[model samples]
Target: MLKLELPAKYEALRQRVRAFVDELLIPIENASTAGTDLKPEIRARLEDEAKKRDLWMLHVPPEFGGQAGDMFSKIVIWQELGRSIAIPPRRWAVFGPDPGPILYQLAEHQREKYLWPVLRGEKKVAFAQTEPGAGADPAGMSTTAVRDGDHYVINGRKRFIGFGDEADFIQVVALTDPAKRARGGISSFLVDTDTPGFRVVRQLETMMIDRPVELEFVNVRVPAENLIGREGDGFRLAQSWITEGRLARHGARGAGVIERCLELGVAYANERTTFGSKLADRQSIQFMLVDMYQHLYQLRLMLYDTARRFDAGEDIRTESYLCKYFGDESAFHAADRCMQIHGAIGLTTDYPIETFWKQARSFVITEGPTEVMKMVVARKVFEDFTKTA
Candidate 1:
């Protein structure tokens, strides 16, 4: 019941995205990117070009004025875009709102005011959940939002939120009942950035070029209408988003990086001479190349299988974690091997391998760390093992 090949319907679009990334983006990436930031003119022009090809808004539903590329199609396109170090998270987000699926829970008027504008790139929204002390432990959060008649008074500190520094508003998760925590007391709220008492504490810079930030909420009052879904649905809703991200965010990106590393490594080995012979002739380098290829081969099967299951509407929590965990580990391994092939040259920015290595390192820690992913996998294993016992 698994479709391993690219679906026929998406083949054209896949190739188009692939060509755009390989021929256009990668070739000009070094020149166009000022350090880690893409030049404004280049970003604008690329978006405009994607628009001309009708390639924008690939993930939204058709009813929402999007092309409605399913989970499988997203995998296909992102793998290609991921091969390029220069492309941002959303490759086809040129013309509209590429807000994650979280916005689907918005009310009609809320969508009109918040979601639609974001899909159009007219506004940006950030998700706030990880607290100052609660990175992987969502249930350990201390932020609280108490109801105050017409509005909820929120006070909390959220750390390492991507896009928080630039977003017009934020989707926040708060503890309404400390006794229940993630069980039945947590809630989601949308708070505008300019709301009194809401403040950006600082931008957190890492080896990653695009910096994320921390935010402090001091008695920030949000209207009752700003609540997403019903109270206590926060953790449930956030789980869906997090689980989905386990596949798309680091998984797909890692797969692309793996593929690129192998490509560059093989080419360099064949062309470079070492110790009076082609580097490819050395067994040490040959074994690494072979191992890299095998890893990608197996990764492709796992990636497509998991994606097919997701599109078929199956519960993929365990499978997604496994895929993401493998991706996080395997990508860095592949990059390190490739860099070994490139020797010291790979350590410098003159080559993209250095950046790829850092990005792969970053992937291991983002979304959910490999350790958390392993925890999810272990839970599923124990549950299945004990079934009917």
Candidate 2:
């Protein structure tokens, strides 16, 4: 298990981010909620301010111009950012530069070309692993990359790519050899958005907080050098990336939604009155609030425990599945109860509670569906017990 010894500098970093959000991000989000777009100039200005405050790319390694934050520290930062209505954009600006699955298997030139630019905020990256036909079973993907001289010509369509419209580069998975399938036939490539034949088919507007896109690669050509790692290691690399990413999502984002639900519930209980008495005084409301608190407490402990284990270099696939399942279920339940407590106002866009409820619902399907996670848990349990027996 990972220990929770906070470095002396952790508190200072936390305070800096909290102050930045309070003074800058909250105002921008409020304007956005009023149907005003955060103009590019305004975003740039805030980005400059954030950079000046040394708050950029806190999640990446220090060598990559990041603060090299640990899992626990990232949990703190993400939770603080989650309190605001504009968390998606603000958090993206601060931590978006960090490399994902591609980093683990980056070629030398690829790292300098793609990873470095991301860390410096000069470029944005997105992963294109999912397709319309390959939602859960990635190996079932039909996206093909055929070798042509010194380059590979990729032709396929990827859907629901998060932040795809604004990404400077995308890491794509393709079948190099269908005979081996995922065993040694899958390959990954770094494709520049400006490359010929690469096009954004459409921007997909979802119920969640972020905007995703569908991309079409019509004979997109990537040089051999753009390939990441060995030709057949893409599946393994993707698994590692998703396992770590899912943990972060469950630990940080899920925890944040739960905390926000509790906050809104508490505030509502104090202000709203029913039957000539304050809602806080009602036994039913009190019981619901207590339930929300209990859920949050249990989820946080599980999240932190899993995160600590991950940071300690332990294999946490099973734990991550458990975290993802419980995290989504707990947050959704809390958000539902919160909405029930708020009555009609909860359904309206007038408050952030409605938005939180939508985001929680998305969590149930995003990283891995709740059903898939449970299956993973059962499989792991069966394997472990069988070994002991």
Candidate 3:
């Protein structure tokens, strides 16, 4: 039988993280810096506080000098951190590094130089897989990395790279063996931003605060040692890493949004009124609260169940898609309805409901679009059908 209740140890950890998010972080969130990160001084102080409270690096493993908590622990941390915009503690000091799976495939010597720094928060990196023409399909990438003696000469453009401007280097996914393409033909190379031919061409303006950018590479030379995983394994490495991201970022994040929306909506319903009675007294308003709560409840169950299975080494890729698809829709619709219940005040920046609404909608498209999510689930369904047939 599977354990449904969090152990005392996990519960204690959860409470600590919840206190940090609610008492410490939420207060800071109301400031002008709300949704933006905390101020430098405040961030340092809070990070120090988190470290002292033994609430840091829950996502990392003991091998990396981290708590090396189980996948469920990491999911719990993400759920809490997802409550706010300032997440992963920037330095990954509190949440551990999100360096792509390929980094873990690096040779020990190469890891010492590239991987350790990221884990230590001394550096940041971006994965360059999508091009102007290759948004969903990695096989269609036109970027090429031709080997020239000791280095691979990379020539390509990567679009919509989040935080690319600030990244120390980019893991450029390039075609090393065109004949194979997605079939063990693509490769990933960590190209330094300071390289002569590598540059951030421009930062693409976005509705969200963070500005993703386009990176241009004109014959950028990447050292042989910088190759991550093996040559012609780029697509495989990318798919492996993106699976975790879809679950953690999109799936877990959607549930967290519901949690926040419920907090705001319920509070408003209890305190605010149009006439002589509280909004909570109105059946319509109460129904909205119930619906949002229901979504949160269901999403939380799905997320936790999925996290538990994942930790137990079960294949949960299909479930990950389902969780994200359902979670995104539930959270977005709930937030939209809550905003409608709040009247005009909800439209203002003073209220987080509008932000939640906007972000929730965007969440559907990120990681994988809603359509793609359904496609993945369908693929799984048909695979099972064929097996039985």
Candidate 4:
């Protein structure tokens, strides 16, 4: 009974993002495949072009020079960007730096200093909440920050931090009081990447395209003004940001991967031959294609429904988990089917399907593991049922 319709404005936005990806980002990503790192020169060139087109930071608020899109609009745009193996659209990288918990908690001066520069792409920031010891449980983080007269000295290690090495600012969570834990002991801080004692100990090469970093903080000093929100709201704020981000990743990026997989499958089916006939003529191939289509359609509907609910200001904590679970699983199914249709070529780098497969597999673990997401959904369902009973 869920309505699957998109507003005309959002549809148009989708097309715009799709066009940019097809025309610009795709080529850049194609060129960067052999190189382990995204070339700074190439990135600068593409970012410049994106800015010229007013496509700089699509998710940031308009007051900060971004489009200020709603959740629905973001879902549509990010889905289109995720359709290719290329560098994500310029805005995608800016997502973490944009409006979320950070923006809402920014002091007036802090907003003007850090947030605005970030929106303009003059500075880059990355989330650094995950640690070597703390994967899913932020409450167990060992990172500690003790307040000094004018600054807070931090000491800890963070791992699997996305874009951490390249970021100018790092958003980190540390324990200020172990007794309060997640309730009132944890705090979030924005630390300059160049601050003394903050170092990139190692870079983790993920199965996916981006290489995140493992950072070491040795008595890193951060101004007291760098604290985001209240001293103890770090865990709550982090949870909200992470939950929303997980939904976006699953719904939008997963949809894009599914679409790309279908494209690869269909292209192969039409031309690939076996037993003197095209693969498209084979009943087995046709069935697989149909099944893939079913999964894609189902995922798309769920993504839109969840996005709409989020935009309507509904509490989507449980729905977000459902979408993440379904979106990742469905996309993996589509990618596997598409690779099967391509035979050996799909396994090779000659086509993008192999990369897509790897990326999809990584999604099954990122944000939250698939098993963890399912448990969250189950708990929510049980709680709701008990309340009604």
Task: Choose the strongest candidate by TM-score.
Answer: 1
Which residue pairs show collisions in model 2?
none
**lDDT tens digits, residue span 1-389, model 2:** 11334456766776787798778876666444322224566667776887788787777666555676467666667656766666452234444455764574576777788877776668888888889998777888889999999999999999888877888989898999989878999888889999999999998777665667899999999998888887887888778777765666654666667777788888999999888998989999989888877776776677677777777988878888887778778778878888998999988876777777777788788767888888878987888788652
TM-scores of the models, in the order given: 0.95, 0.89, 0.91, 0.90
Q: Look at candidate 3 and tell me the lDDT of residue 140.
A: 91
Clashes in each model (backbone N, CA, C under 3 Å)? 3, 0, 2, 0
Q: Which stretches of candidate 4 lie over 4 Å from their true place?
A: 1-4, 26-29, 33-37, 88-91, 94-101, 387-389
- Show where candidate 2 strays beyond 4 Å: 1-12, 26-28, 33-38, 89-91, 387-389
- The lDDT, on a scale of 0 to 1, for candidate 2 is 0.76
Summarize candidate 4's per-residue lDDT along 1-389 as a digit string, tens digits.
12456788886777778887788766665565334544667656766777776677777656655675577877887688788776632235623345454655577868776777776558878888888998866689999999999899999999988778888888898999989988899999999999999999998776666677899999999999999888998888788777667667676788888888878888899998899999999999988888777777887787788878888998888888888878888888888889999999889888877777887887877778789888889997788787652
List clashing residue pairs in candidate 1. Answer: 96-119, 97-119, 97-120
Cα displacement (angstroms), candidate 3, residue 234, comes to 1.4
Backbone steric clashes in candidate 2, count:
0
Per-residue error (Å), model 1, residue 386: 4.0
Model 1 agreement with the true structure over 1-389: per-residue lDDT tens digits: 12346667767877888777876688875576664456788888888777777777766778778887467776776677778777654233443567777787788868987888887778888989998889888889999999999999999999988889889999999998999998988988889999999999998878767677899999999999998888898898788777667776667777888888888998899999977999999999999988877777777788788888988999888888887878778888989999999999888877778777887888787778889888878887888788683
Tens digits of per-residue lDDT for model 3 on 1-389? 12346778777777888888887766665452433344567667776887888766666666766775466776676667667644422222343456655677778988887889988889888878888888766689999999999899998888988778888988788999999999989998888889999888898765655567898999888888888878988888887677767666666767777777777888888889788999989999888878877777777788888888988999988988888788888878878987988889988877777767777777777666788889879988888887652
